[model samples]
Target: MADKRTTTPAGPSTSLQRGKACLRCRKRKMRCDGVKPACQQCTKAKKGDACEYDDGKGKTRTQLMREQIARLEARVKELEKSSSSSSHGSPPANLSLSASASPTPFPLDMDSSPWDSQWNGIPDFPAVNGITDSYATEDPPIELAQMLLEIFLPHRHQVGLEVHVGRLRDSLHLPLGEQRHPVLMNSIYLWACYLSRPGSLCEHEPLYLSRALAAVNDAVPNPSKVIDFIQASCLLSMYFLSNGRLLEGSYHASAAASLAIQWGLHQLGSTDLTVGVIPCDRESTFRLNPAKDAIEQGERVLAFWQVFNLDRCWSVALRRPATIPDSKHPWTSVITPWPQRMEDYETGELEINSGSPTIQAFFVHQAQVSPVVGGFSTFAHRVKASALFEGASRLSSSWYPRLSSSPSFTENFRAFEHTITRFTTTLLPLHQLAATLPDEKTSLLLIHSLAHASMIHLHQPFLEDQGSRETAVRAARSLAVVAKHISDTDYDYLDPFIGHCWVLGSEILASEIAQLQAAWSPHPASSELRVELNTLLFSLTKVAAKFPLFGYQATKVQKLLDAI
Candidate 1:
């Protein structure tokens, strides 16, 4: 080979050099032909737009991760400081003394409180119960807390626990010892844990719940903490109810109601200053000075409506007398202003002297004067409809059997029906057929479902009349249609209350089917009814797969269908 003419020396071997790759290539573990602006692999994969490179001055991925961990640890230490300080020594005796000094109209019996029994079966967390000082002083891991918060934010509005999101975020930035309300914080975490994805989180539900219970148990006896205590109790009530713990939920609900009354939330902005009047300057009868800022005032206003909405909704669900009745609690009838949007409070747009109309007057005056210009928010409208739904439920329960002889029942029913009809006609335009966004559509469907459900409930007791029977059947059909549409489409967002409407509507239809099948001769529309029932059941099963409570409901509906 040396003798061969100018044998070419072995050229440098063509080898791949381990050059720094673009971020996308590095993440994908691919070889990068390091090109400017875009890499070959990314371009070939049609992801050139996503291809990026780390500048020499920028930190590496590992370094960024470490920084995040450090921040989280700092937050945890802050949270721990408050707990550690409190646990190290007993709270001042003056705290209790000052609480007692305040004149509470209906004082809670601290000795034999109802909430004491409700906490029995909940397991104690070693960390929460102070088994070891170290555990008691530690805050929850940041990862777990973050996960829980993610689950809670989207669903809070559905349950009527819409606190100021901006304020909450800011609170997280403050030192742990400076956090505003421990009871509220614990309650928030408790519900977040309850709603977390199915796994170890489910096992920790009772632990968080116990922590909340302990906090509220302590806070209730202190007059200065009453407002925050009531807020926590209200959240706990819904949390229990959503988890199928009805008795505990009812107890907490009643407790919240009592505290709300004691704190004068029910009587806020009362026109008659003598009845349940808050201790404020007489000149400012229309506006209370209890709240120090717009955010606090907004929360107070929203809290009242939250409790009102729960009382009305659950009374119908449980078939029990409502704890806050309009006749006995004249404050319930007072025309307090509707709550402003959370953003308004955050931006300082809501003033103490803002002349917002009371919900009662809005319904009576604004609605009549400008039906199309409805001033109520979606939530406010939903609550208003809930009131009507509750009233219809109560009337049916009390007078269905005695309708033939009860003139008063007939008169009340007529008036209530008129009110509901007017309200339905006055719903916001966005809640009509014109809604375009997915969320708006879902909300519209919910409101309409509730309206129809209320109609079915109202007319079911009067089914002997052909007109009433037709109305019930029509409403039931409308509900089934909406439910089926929601399921068929990929509109996956539904509130807990929306599930309630589905179950109620299903019951009405199932009952009607059973009645028809029981008749001596089958009804002419039996075949059509069977088809509709099957369609509705299919929709329910599909939607149930998304929500745990709805899944339980679907199981019950399946059993009903099997029997039929």
Candidate 2:
């Protein structure tokens, strides 16, 4: 009693009170607590759910753990059984594979290593067999299909769309192979063809379409495999439908939906495959009538475009070096500069990643005109053009100044001039190609993009420059033609595109009139001309303000109106 005065009873062990014992230990699995969430005994013993207290109340924690362990063991057994049956039923036609084995790399590069590497977030095509149906060869399509499997799936590597197309074209010409792995083969064929179609500049060939379809038809032999395969098939078809191939694309996509239900795959890969299908009823020359598939495809594609635009712009911002002001100390930390060569140039080659083939052609042509700076500036303009269609409101006074040029205003003007010319010349033709296609939705999308591009060009600051009045006027006149296109289109089904363009058109008109008025000289009827222009600008401003995206544009115009 005399010695105990210095110390009180020790507190309960904090760890034991906090419920930190491993599940197996709690469940009386006859193993140490290990006190880990994932105990070695549970993991190594494959008793995943065997962790709880052994206190017996006929319904204690250990009893629940035992039940859970039984269930998990049952599930593991089922999966093992299914996998073993599938493997035994049909071995791979060309190359045998197991999930545990190291995969062979398929060689399928389109041009070179750079193309084979990641661009933006997309991985380069794998080194798979490059043979296509169009290639001068007579090998049975199975060989090419085998090549595709090796490139895309046998190794499960991410590949670009182009490589898939090359293998598909090869497979298409060859005779059909045995239905050993129909679902997988069907998937490959369908996706490759879908991705091969020219849509936008960013539109490179799709590498998996044909393989997916071929896998379904000849890759997986069991109709039961359809349940497993249908989701991927639908994905490839959706990719096609989204890229302006609605008619034929819808057929495969619909088939996928039916098969998904038939094979009971809806639960396993619901959104992974069928999340995009919607309900609608509209006949079109280009795309299918609005049904679950079309609706799903439309929404998904629109979402993709939105994110794609945001990413391109964000990438530009990330690439630009931090231009610290001179007000800071001269003894700044050393920072390495980005590589400047297009070959050496990262943003130096292409700033806006549209992923459209048509745009790439423009890049190639401009490269010849002025290989380094000129080409870079021209591409920079293309990126700016995207601003018109991209922002929440097309007409908003967003600064899409040339990215590759010097920060000086004079440099911006020069870049703007080159970009305008390139935009006018190429953009129109690209839209024209869309018009020729039967799909109204695709055509409208193309037209909208073209209109936005023109509008951005018209709104560049040169319109207010006295020395550039003539050039500004020319661009304005060209823009008027695009405006007429926007005005003429029936925007009933195209509220998104129309709203974007209408705001842009208003911005262009207002800016142009403001430039002309600013350049006005003291002439006899100057007051009357000014008043007339003001009225027109006011009307445009009212229209622009009504749109959500262009409300900012409208507000700016109203302020300008007040000042005038």
Candidate 3:
């Protein structure tokens, strides 16, 4: 069969250049006026999210989204024809333009959203034949699906934040697609399988992953259901990253960001807060309606930050540019406030709703007063920390190789080091003030680890400087301290990215250990250094056993320890 395509919906006509357009235009078979970064057609159509040039390597982010959702829509269509499928169910809620006959454009104004019970009064309907339709082959029985969900819940933060876990748990009986959406349900299943490694249930990983992948775009056309895809994409991206699949991981990571943009999650509440957010859909073509409840609103906010955190940290992790640009770029402007904890939203304790430019403020050293640092929520800190790590990484030689001696590099270094100093010394209370649960403990460890690693990576090129080298030494020592605080249980709960994180400072530890071992009469503290090194290594060894994504990095870290 030939490829299916669509033209850009009609927009204001303007003078035509008649040259190459963006990959989005090319695929849509629209006329080309070839523009850079974003095309005029896309700009006018306000599809800045989908506008990107062809680098001639592979599919554009928009193409991937189209294909992913195309399959999902097909699946839904297939179910539509199934004699047994239900036809009475309602889509999540209405909000959007004529992007497709299926999804309407969102309005820019919040008060205008169709969120009242009058609009969404259609009662919830059970999915057709339960959740079985998501799978192409065998659908797991309800009993098995519940078990997998139980396995996933404990680790859902790593997949993507599940706002109102109780609600999710209670909704399991609602049928998979409506328990949220099949895309999200399947995404959780694959995570359960991945995290359940070495167990008999792990054998089902591929089945769930395939189903999850196929569900990618099912809700793209449904305004109310697109958040399901945004969230599932985030989970799927993390899954690939955990297994060390960088390209696909990066692909889906950006896909989540793209989906968020298309869904208007990025600029959520921008109009209400009067937060100078220039909408990606300038015409307010795809307005995100006010959420049905605070919990629902919290879900949208959480999804944006997860995508932001992934984009910021993983771009540095994968050594690529962030898909979510931080400049005042209208296309990618993120006006959403930093996220609050689930409890905060549930209890209406949303102090982080001021809505200034979050990433921008944090990077500009305005965090303390910028509403970002005000909320001491787990997610608030996590988001800011990733931005700091990304900021620090940008100054590292690893990100901009061959610029060590450049004047601009020297200037940027001071700012990066200053930010690290403020965070570690004044802002971030290093004490385990909030961590208790295994997951929380591991999360705090990851944040602390990233903070120290940021200093290490930034100071790497300045290793010849005594002060810079000692700063790195202190950071490495701090890494060991953080690692020791984590119990063995936290190892299973550790984020897969932390594996790469361990490799960062272990080499520094190895160097220090080697130096101490060579001394004929080492300092009394030398043995303690060895113990600290051993602690970090122990964590990595445990990690290697559990997470395949971390295995390669784990091996590298073990070799460093062995050589010493």
lDDT of each: 0.60, 0.34, 0.64
- List candidate 2 segments past 4 Å from native: 1-306, 310-416, 427-464, 467-470, 487-489, 495-547, 551-564
Report RMSD (Å) for each prediction in the order shown. Answer: 14.2, 26.2, 23.4
How many clashing residue pairs appear in each of the predictions shown?
0, 77, 12
- Whole-model alpha-carbon lDDT for candidate 1: 0.60
**Where does model 1 exceed 4 Å of error?**
1-138, 141-147, 175-178, 270-289, 328-332, 347-375, 400-407, 428-443, 487-493, 517-524, 539-552
Among these predicted structures, which one has the highest lDDT?
Answer: 3
**TM-score, predicted candidate 2 vs. hidden true structure:** 0.28
Residues 155-205 of candidate 3 have per-residue lDDT tens digits of 777555656777776767775445687778788877775665444345445
Per lDDT, what order, best first?
Answer: 3, 1, 2
Off by over 4 Å in 3: 1-140, 175-177, 271-281, 351-355, 370-373, 398-411, 426-437, 512-528
396-487 per-residue lDDT for model 1 (tens digits)? 77774646677787877777677777777766443233223333355566777777778878887787788888778877777777765563
Q: Per-residue lDDT tens digits of candidate 2, residues 399-473?
A: 345632445644544454454465455443433432221122323333444344343444443445555544534
* Of candidates 3 and 1, the better by lDDT: 3
- Write down the TM-score of every candidate: 0.67, 0.28, 0.69
List pairs with backbone clashes in candidate 1.
none
